[model samples]
Target: MNFDDQPHRRLNQLTGEWVLVSPHRTKRPWQGQEEESDRATLPKYDPACYLCPGNERAGGAVNDQYDGVFVFTNDFSALLPESPDSQPVADGLFVAEPEPGLCRVICYSPRHDLNMARLGTERVAAVVDAWCREYEELGVREDIGYVQIFENRGSVMGCSNPHPHGQIWATGATPMYPASEDARQAVHLREQGSCLLCRYMEQELASSERLIFENDSFVVVVPFWAIWPFETMVLPKVHMTSISEMEGKQRLDLADALVRLGIRYDNLFQTSFPYSMGIHQRPTDGGNYPHWHWHMHFYPPLLRSRSVKKFMVGFEMMAMPQRDLTAEAAAARLRELSETHYLESL
Candidate 1:
């Protein structure tokens, strides 16, 4: 089957979801100049930076002199713990629930100049340890049901801060996306008597076309059903449902995978790559989710050129998500690129 000829195709494993990949229309060579900018050279220590050590935040709270990984409650949290009970308006059609959750910011390092890609493997491991601590602490809370760890890099990704950091959101219930995945996995497991993602990972590993990089513990691949041009997912070889369940070595391996993938992304455009990345794991609702698999998603916006980005507009907004590049092709390109930063030579 010529995937290029087909206008739309449905992914069977993902509940028959369709994506429009207009490869012919977007088959153009990249023509963007790589320019050096002072913005990339972040300061080692910014006295005025709110996230830096020994700095005062907006709410009159001061940060301690943290050297390694540090996590603190978001100065401005989107979800508060002291929310009132959810109220329903009209009938069951219109309902609103009070969201009670915790938002935390995890500082990757004391140095502001280093991005995730630039941070050494050992330093990245420290960040993973901090994530484990946060997950365990927040997951134990009776009020929390899901823990989301994510990073938004570059201004294009709507990140106001340039510091090397990520955010953690622990909520009262499983989110819509994860809930959908959970349902699908459960259905697949009941039908096939095996885990859904585990089976898919096995197929992907055998194909090897969509794979970007892999170590003993983790595999980074551009999923066959990826919606973004440069989208990728980092999956664990072993089926660990949540970060809290990860052992010390697995945690370190995860951190190493993150740093390596980040370095590749930065090298791709020779710029600080903009992406919305997040992890998907089992919910903390106390039920055993043997079907669920742990993975991280990286969604980058750049399409044919660095300056020109793909937007979900017109048909995409009205209909379904679309991409111009196939996942296999994207993965091949990323695999060809070196993990080292292009800017390191300059």
Candidate 2:
């Protein structure tokens, strides 16, 4: 079947969800308004920015004037570290439980204007190292079951602070998505006698249609069931359950893969693409998850241009999620974009 010219559905093995892909819809011309890209050059250091080094945060916490990577507990954390433990109260019709966790913010760079694409691979690798450290520290806690490392980039993604940083939210229980993935992977392993994503990665490598880029250790692809227009997943070439297992050189390769993907995203529409990127790994609840395989997902909203974005509305909200662009088509566009940032050309 001609997937690029037809309407079809793809299954998301991780989440057990299906996305409808209508590739022919791309031909429809858009008469929509475009958002004004924030082209104003930001200063290297914003003294007023709370995340900047040596600045006083709103919570009256003073940041250390350290260089390179920096990490601190969130001044206004969503999850509290000192919440009292209580069993889930079941009162026939209603039930509730107390959740305890820790939230931390990791500053990717001291520079306020730099992001993953502009910061280069070495700096991104440092961020990766910081992620590993936070995961290891938080996972050892008896109360923490999962460590979620994620970044929200650009004002469009509702990122309050533009400073180069990401967050780690370690929770007392495995969240819904990860729990679902764990179940799926476990079932896949039991039924197929192998890891789900590892086998899927091999399939993608053999097909090469949905693949964007690959290095010595990692491969980036627009997943077969991507909901967003340019959603991409980064998977380690080897079968691994967590980032903690990565060797030094493998981490460097992952960093390089991220930077290259970031550069391509920026060059795609000549804008610093906004997306919510996160890593999904095995739960830290201490269960042996030999079936789990770690992967990072980049879910970008941009559809046709910088301003045009896909929204979850109407059918997507009341029914199942859908997308106009096919995964193969999105991968092709990403594949064609330059690895160098657009600003570098000028």
Candidate 3:
């Protein structure tokens, strides 16, 4: 039976969740909502932008005149580092505990116009190095259980500023999705005596059906059970526990993969593609997790054209996530896009 022609559900091995896919739905008419394109000609540096060098932020803190990548504590952090050690026990259903953590913002570049796609490979490597440093430092802290590095690109993805930047949130508690992924990976290692992602990556590489792009050290593929329309995962060929484990050459190769993929994404829709990208790795709790295999996830909302987007409503909120595009079709779309940026091509 051809899975692409029929309505079916696919299981996510890492998170143990099912996603409903209906390939025929893509042929239906689009009478739903459409979003305005946020793409525009941006200046190299915005004087009023808080992330620009030597500018005053919204929280009244002035940024230093730094070059290249700049790191600083978030002006308005979500988690307070000075949270008191206290727990309130409830009668039966309610229980709470104080979470002590810290947040940081990393300015990818002083230039306000460049996203990862236009940011040359050399500068992208610098960002990768900064991620390794932040992960290593935060992982050693006694209070931080998980260090999450993520970026929300475009206004639709909740990015308030257009500056090329990302955030690192070190928290005392592991987030829900990562917690589920960690559990499933550990179970796979114990039961099958192999890493979960490593095995999954092998199958993807063998077929190349869902494979989009690859470098010497990393491979990007639309996972078979993707919930988002253009969701993809960057899996390292070699099994490593965390971002810190990447070797010198591996770091550069990973940076290449990122730039190429970003360019393809923007070129595919001929606009600034929006996505919520994040890296998941071993927890910072100093536990022996040989089962942990680090990977990066990209969840882009654009389903069809630049104006149309996939919203999670109705069935997704009440039951489970659903998608009209199959993984193979999404990969084929991405795979055919040029690695060069569209503006350069024109």
Candidate 4:
């Protein structure tokens, strides 16, 4: 049975979850009824934009005019540092506990029109440095257990602000995804006596069918169990548990990998791509996790075109996650795109 012409379920080794891939369903045609996000022209600096440098935020806090990158605490943080400890002592069905943590925003660039793809390699490296600093700072905290660094680009991804930025949510407890990964990685280490991601990276490198791009330090590939059409994972070449472990040269290589993938993404649909990007790493729970290997995931919702996007509904909401494209097909499409930014051609 050829997987390209059949429907099959793929297992995600990290989370031990399964995804349905219907490669034959790609033959279906769309009615062009999907929602299209605005691709309007943006200025280098918008005086009214709150995230722009020197602009006053909604909470009456003014941003500094510093260059390069900036970091600030979220005015409306979902998690707080001073959450009171409270939990039900009884082992009941509706038990609850206090979730204490911190949230901060990292402005990738001062230019409002620029995203990571167009930020240039140097500026992207600066952004990477800021990420490393924030991760280390938060990881050393006594109250923080996991630091989630993620970015939701474009308005379609629920990003209210147009400025290029990402948020960090440091929690006092390990979240569901990371917790699942930890348990699976621990189990794999016990059985195979090796890091799970490290071994998986080796396998992907040997196969090279689903790989999109790679650098001296990082490799980008569409995961075997990818649910989104163009979902990609960036894995470090070496075994490292978190961004804090990256050295000077590895950080620059990561920036290079990100820029190449971002450019390919924009060139694919000939528009500013919309996606949710995040980093997955070991929990900062003060425990040694030799099994963990840090990685980044980019889950782009676009399916066939710039206007059309893959939506998670019906079965995905109530049952299992599904997708129409195969990881190899998606990787091939991305790999064929030029690394040079499309706008740079003009």
- Return the top candidate by TM-score: 2
Ranking of models by TM-score = 2, 3, 4, 1
lDDT of each: 0.84, 0.91, 0.91, 0.91
Show model 1 residue runs off by greater than 4 Å: 4-6, 12-16, 28-39, 84-92
- What is every candidate's alpha-carbon RMSD to the true fold? 2.1, 1.4, 1.7, 1.8
Q: Which ten residues in a row have the lowest lDDT in candidate 1?
A: 31-40
- What would the TM-scores of all predictions be? 0.94, 0.97, 0.96, 0.96
Positional deviation of 266 in candidate 1, in angstroms? 0.5
- Candidate 3 structure quality by residue, lDDT tens digits, 171-214: 99888888999999999999999999999999999999999988
Q: Write one digit per residue (lDDT tens) for candidate 2, span 42-81.
A: 7899999999999999999999996899999998898987
| Superposed model 4: Cα runs more than 4 Å off | 30-39, 84-91
Worst 10 residues of 4 by lDDT: 32-41
Provide the global lDDT of candidate 3 against the true structure: 0.91
Which should have the higher lDDT, number 2 or number 3?
3
Compare candidates 1 and 2 on lDDT and give the better one: 2
In model 2, the runs with Cα more than 4 Å from the true position are 34-38, 85-87
User: Looking at model 3, which ten-residue stretch has the lowest summed lDDT?
Assistant: 32-41
